[model samples]
Target: MAKDYQGEEILVVRRSLFDELGEFQGINADVDAYLPSLLNPENNFFMDRGAAEDDPSHKQLIPYCIFRVKDDQGTRYLHYTRGKSGGESRLHAQVSIGIGGHINPVDQREDHLGFDTYMAGVEREIDEELNIEGGHTNKIVALLNDDSNTVGQVHLGVVHMIDLENDDVAANEDAIANLAFTTLEELRGELYDRLETWTRCCVDVIEEL
Candidate 1:
């Protein structure tokens, strides 16, 4: 059975605006080229999630954060398996490198939606999912899109690469299981086939990011 998401509002921008800015298949590392206009108060707003879920006219803005750290060996990224309890049922059981969620009305500031408001939601979403004992800096590295599937059709991803001071992180939700940090080579090797579509997209061009 499908979960009832009535009354839930998520941040979204018109698909027309996305096309106007320039749309691509996978990851586009040109963030500065589109973020300003995309997050402008006049360009985006909150909408009923149930209605937005299937509507291709709107694209939900998701902050997909990738946590990474450089240790003795090499660079490693935080990864996990999506448990059934996750909100996106289609991605359950798949391995994911990113950690984030939907932006809601709570992220809005006094009826205004901008980069600050968008980032507030990003921080909140990450906090709700994980516990980080170390410091980190978040940088918006790219924008992700995938029109080949139902889930991807209605959602857009803003990829953030978070550079962690250390690998002291733990999952706070059951949705994130088997949490661990691994090298890029490992992710591209044995784990490549098990990765979710978005993660696979990010992995394919992560070096540039």
Candidate 2:
């Protein structure tokens, strides 16, 4: 059964704001240009997820994090498959490199909403999904958008690159399956075809970097 989002309130920005900030089809690396205004409290609000999911006028802000570790051979990235128990029914069973989800009311601070709240939600989502045994550095490297499919129409992604000192990571939830670290070549090769649309876009962004 599909999970109900009626009672949930997630953070979102107006689609008009996105267009006004200069919209693009895929991943945009220019975070500085768009993030400030998009994350501004005046430009965002918490809406009922049931309505937001079907409403393209609002884009749900999702922090899509990609974990990485540098080894003797080269840098490897963390990847996994979304299991049946995942929240987004449309993305279940799809391969992905991102580790994140919707920013909700719980992320807010005393009726306040901003980047700090968003980051708090990001950290909460990551901890709920994975167990990392080492220190890491996180950077917001890009923003993802895809309007070609039903799943992408009302969502916006903030891509994060989390560099770990060690690749000691494990899945903490049933939603994350076959969690493992893989090389860029492996991901760009055979696994490319299996990646979710947003993950595919992230792979392209990584390749260009």
Candidate 3:
């Protein structure tokens, strides 16, 4: 049977309003104060992923979540992966440092306020993609974009950094693999070229991660 996308309706904004992603911002509580004016309610609509991805006139908001895993003393490394079996084929096993998907309407409700819908989507995607074994703290890190590629042109990533206090996070599905906690130096070296466009673009804002 074909995979049921469950009527996915991704929220998106104009590609131009961001302007070099405003040099990429890693926001905390202040994201709420800044987001309302950025999102045009009319431009934000739900459509099939296939069509939504090809339209460059708009940029979809995908919450890109990357968790930092640690154990006893301090930070170990950052978590990342690539889509594998059962996962979306378009990713084609390419490396993706962040874990998130489109903000669907089901991820929203009347109770959602400010960037809540996007944050809700972020939470939903992380749960579906990874298995966290212990305590963790999540914070919205940055708004990332790349008009440099076809896929990048159509999507804008809001980076979320999750600092996991345990060493137990793992990919729970065959659709995802190569789960690892790699250092920033390694990411800048060997794995740099392997990253998906949005990952490379968002790297600057998440330097502390």
Every model's TM-score: 0.97, 0.96, 0.79
Per-candidate clashes come to 0, 0, 2
Q: lDDT of each prediction vs. the true structure?
A: 0.94, 0.91, 0.65
Poorest 10 consecutive residues by lDDT, candidate 3: 20-29
Candidate 2 steric clashes? 0
Candidate 3 lDDT tens digits, 92-160 = 667767787778878775544236666677788888988889887888655665666566667766667
Candidate 3 at 4: error in angstroms?
A: 9.7
Model 2 misplaced regions, further than 4 Å: 1-3
Q: How many steric clashes does model 3 contain?
A: 2
Error of 3 at 75 (Å): 2.9
**lDDT assessment of candidate 3:** 0.65
Which digits, one per residue and each the tens of the lDDT, describe model 2 over residues 55-134? 99999999999999998858999999999998888898889999999998888865378888988899999899989998
* Candidate with maximal TM-score: 1
Off by over 4 Å in 1: none
